[model samples]
Target: MYQVSNGIGFYVLATYFLAAIESKFLRAIPYEIELIPQEEYRSKFCYSVAECRASYPRAMDRGNDFFKYLLSRVVVSSVGGIPKYNVDEDTVIRYMWDVHQAAVDVGKSQLSDVSFYSSETERDFFMDFLLAVEFSVATLYRPYINSTAEFLVGFPHRPLTDQDRNVLASDVTVREKAFMSSVKFFSRTNEATGGLFLTVWKIAMTSEAGRAAGRFLIKRLLLIPSL
Candidate 1:
């Protein structure tokens, strides 16, 4: 079962990422005041063409690195051998942001370290927090979403039956490569999906309604059920 508690936590994250995306670009919408994030709302999550240009050495390498580092680090510790408590929304949000910043901070200070954050960020590299969607789905009601991600309107963009999260957890491939290792190396859904699926996200991030629809998706598809 999905953690009832992480629903709100994911919502906060979804909201932040959506807002961040909006802040990056502005588009005029029909009958809307103040350039809101999207003008033609078709909000989807599978953005980033990192998987497209596989020839680029660092195209998405950092994003994968960040995701790998974050998966285990973003956890609530169990105390006294009791079952681990559900991570509260504030804690999850704060800890994740803090960790993200910590990784980025070393770059701002120009520190020389081999930590994933510092080393990966050594040059301008990609960091697709969008992969957080994969993480969220990995723990969602439908844990096999990588194979069956139904979009807001299109046919299931990348319906794949990925049932090896447990096995992959202990494998070097997934541990080192995160979502990429999970989808790209096995089954038929290869990294090429990154090329087309990103179109879905662009449509979603184009208008206010589009953005709202996406956030609404976060609430309904992910947040509400778990909550």
Candidate 2:
């Protein structure tokens, strides 16, 4: 789920980019607001809606390269953990800005027609280019997960019976059922949810606050017998 503030930031940035494209000029800003340092901006995580709104113009003023780089890092950090990070707002905003800037820059140099959205082919190409850049940046920063061995150990080895297949194909939520089955299968051989929950629990146990939070969450999870 997107944080409300981040979502607002994304909308604001998208509008800004569209405006920049339509006008053929970047929006001018007041001279008083100082530019955020690249490293600091890259590390800054938006924790609230206000922070996201406050930071939007500052990020935009830094230009496309910095924006894109910061965005790529945010995406990487967001997906490196189990619960996943809430960085989508920042990612979407930066991504739109970068794509818009690229289109504008290319239209200036290569096309006789200055408008980027003029040609269907050009629009398609830019869309593909945007996805390609996103993939490339994500791959460059994606963290390595060391769970292959655990996954193999946890996997159900026996061939599925007709009943099992029927249950899998039923109207029930397939992904949730499959995940639950895997956890159950893993628990048959080892404690915890096929080592996944175990790993998280172990990590949580290392600190007092973590342990307290983990216990609270575990209690809540236990109340949900179906889970």
**After superposition, candidate 1 runs with Cα above 4 Å error:** 1-130, 133-164, 167-192
| lDDT for each residue of candidate 1 in 37-143, tens digit (9 for 90 to 100) | 22232121112232112322232333333334444353457668744434444334434444334323322232222232222321111222223343223222132
Model 2: residue 21 alpha-carbon error in angstroms: 24
What local lDDT does model 2 show for residue 56? 47
Candidate 1: global Cα-lDDT? 0.32
Model 2 TM-score relative to the real fold = 0.19
Worst 10 residues of 1 by lDDT: 151-160
